[model samples]
Target: EVVRQYKLGLARHVNEHTGRPLSRATQTYFLVALRSLLRYWAMQGLDVLAPDRVELGKAPSRSLKFLDGDQLRRLLDAPDINDLRGLRDRALMETFFSTGLRLSELARLDRDHINLRTREFGVIGKGRKPRIVFLSDAATNWLGRYLQARQDRWKPLFVRMKGKPDLAPGGPGMRMSTRSIERLVGKYVRLAGLGVKATPHTLRHSFATDLLSNGADLRAVQEMLGHANLNTTQIYTHVTNPQLRAAHRKFHSGNRE
Candidate 1:
């Protein structure tokens, strides 16, 4: 009874809540928690809800959100090159789009993690697995510039400000936080006036979409994105639907309309 009521309540909240509907991703988390509880009860010899009987609601197929080439150029250009902060922001944005790194992976980057000559680096992704991410020529150039302009001996790849009054005694100038990266991305996104709610994750989406659109193999994309499951990488396949439509219109002999 408790399980039934909990399931129904979750469905109602997801379907007709006052605030924003809880995303399917969020719902899956809730379901997993419930399943764990039920499994515990079953292990204790209780005749409570069966964990195996619990099913997660299907997540809707949502299209990927990404900026086009022009929009990307505009965003990269939004940060002023003359200023140190702008230089850092531009490099950060370029790296996000080029490497498709998760926020945490990017946040934890240390100065020694990247080799400018090689332009390739390894990141510890989810599940504590290490994977390689390469920087594009453009990304490399911007990052090189940012590194050259840095006067501080900060240990982090990206940091707040040098000699700032509010900077933590030994904290602020260390590693850049994930939230700070998001704010930097947001600031440039607004300045570029793309007019879409884009986050750092959107840049990651753009990286995958660009690769798939340009005929990169699915398996290669999966490896590059460091997706543990192939299904996670398959999301980019949906974003390529427009290219599929174009090909169909151009080559299909039966469809002359």
Candidate 2:
């Protein structure tokens, strides 16, 4: 009875306090926190509930959010190229889509981390595991143009312009934060009129889905994504309903001549 009450209370807390409708992801996080707390108490020899015995809420499988080819084109073209900020924005968004990097990973990159000649770079992903990510030709080109336009010798690959164009390169004010990258993504998403919620992570999702949809091997994508588990990468395998219908119509026995 106590365990059941605890579960209900947690669910209520999520719905009533967290937000309306309670996101499945947030519910899972709440459950995880509860389990961790239980484990800690159990270790201290408390007569509390067993952590492993607690049931986790099942999250309904939802379609992954990603920009289709047209949307991607529109977003990539949304940034203006006529000015310094525009050039940097173009390169930043291009690099994001090309590399599938998490926002923190992308924002923390230093100029030295990139090898412009090879157009490939290494990033330390989750768990401090290092992996190589390659840039598309378009991404490379924009990055080159952005770098050429920059007069600052800033070591950071991307920097924030603090109101003054004359700020010295490599100064403390030049670094871009993760929040800034999120806002930038939001800005372009609105500008492109995509009518979908696209954070910087959406570009990452698009990158993975694009690879998977084009017949890239699952395991190979797992490696490229730096996922610790193949199951985590499997989520990208879900295709749009239209693609499912097309496949069914093309290959089903009933459709055969």
Candidate 3:
């Protein structure tokens, strides 16, 4: 009953999101989550109706939020590297741009996951699949700066702010949560003063977009992103420069001649 109540509650929640019904993507995700919760509870012998039976309204036709070229440049330069916190943030941003590591994959990384010498990183992506992401020269540079000032003497590549960096300090192993990663990216987005809506996942979108714009193959992008399905990678093709030009040439009044 509580699950059903929440399902009904989503209408009002969706209203707050866009003053309209939930977009198809959002509704599908909501239904999936509700169904999963119902399944878990039912397996425990609890009585509950499955959310899959609920009719999803419709999904809004909208493009994913992404950084434009100029905005991306500004975002990459947003951090103040003189301080420890800034260095860590810059490294996170750079690594995300260089290799579209999902938030969880990044959070799970320890020092061992990264090979500083070879400029490559190991990430266990979706479905526990492992893939290697190369570190760009810029990533290597910031990482070195961050590591040089490091005092944790621990494996976690990034650390939250604590009192002073003690070269040999007494502390437990700390790793940032997925939410923290989101907020950290948000901080830089604001600092960059791009005035664009963005989050950590923005970097991933930027990675895929940049690759498509540069003419990378769909299969190659799929592999780098650790996607099991090639069709999933096809979305980038839809947003490529060639497609954009074709669309304009076909529909624009100025180019229609």
Candidate 4:
């Protein structure tokens, strides 16, 4: 029912008239959920069942979007660290910049996940693949300050209040949800006056961009980013072109001629 209403709302929002999440993907999710509910009821012989008329919706692969360095810097510098929220926001932003973590991986980070001495942190990402990320002194020191201001024994490193991590949607003790972390990123984006569409993932793109611009190998960046495919890292390669163009313009004989 919720999915049905959501589809209707989405259609109405996208068009002048109301529509349903009549997409095959939407149907699959709704039908699968209904089947689960029906099975639970049938185990007790309640005879409940989902109607069989439902079908799946179609979906296709999509490209990702990311932010550039100047815009990124403005965004990072946007957070107000004098207050609690600002401190927390800066810490999260720093973590994203330094680690290139998926929002889920970052949200799941606990006290045990961070190690200041090694300048590293551990993240269990997609497929539960564990990867180690080295944090810069800038990131580590900022994190330390954020943790110091934080007043919680909760497992997640970033929390909302006394007992809850802002991204931890499950509750006080559980790590925050990926959705919650995304929302937090959105709020800070506006505050930073970036004037560009961005989210937490933009930090990941910036991480790769900065690395490529610094002359790090593309393969090395792929490993750091935990991408299964080399093509994913190729997008950041474009960022390096602007720098190359600048260098050529200033030093090349072609410009002199």
Write one digit per residue (lDDT tens) for candidate 3, span 1-257. 66557667765564543367743443444554455556667789998776456554443434344566778778878888888888998888878877767887777777656777866655666666555566666777787888888875676777668555435433334667788889888888888887767877767766655554443443454456676433442223112234323332232121111
* Residues 159-257 of candidate 4: C-alpha lDDT, one tens digit per residue: 664353335543446555677678878887888776666778767866655554443444554556665433332323112234323432332211232
Over the stretch 109-169, how does candidate 2's per-residue lDDT look in tens digits? 9888877786666777776766666676677788999999988787889999766543565
Query: Count of backbone clashes for each model?
Result: 0, 1, 2, 15
Kindly report which residue stretches of model 2 are placed more than 4 angstroms away from their true locations once superposed: 1-64, 163-169, 230-257
Local error of candidate 4 at 245, Å? 29
| TM-score per candidate, chains pooled | 0.63, 0.64, 0.61, 0.59
Better-scoring candidate (lDDT), 1 or 2: 2
Q: Rank the candidates by lDDT, best first.
A: 2, 1, 3, 4
Residue 175, model 3: lDDT of 65
Estimate every model's Cα lDDT from 0 to 1: 0.69, 0.69, 0.63, 0.59
- The reply for model 4, stretches above 4 Å from the true place, is 1-64, 162-174, 230-257
**lDDT over C-alpha atoms for residue 38 of model 2:** 76
- By lDDT, the best candidate is 2
10 residues in a row with least lDDT, candidate 2: 233-242
Q: Which ten residues in a row have the lowest lDDT in candidate 3?
A: 248-257
Q: Candidate 3 regions off by >4 Å?
A: 1-64, 163-173, 230-257
Model 2 error, position 15 (Å)? 26
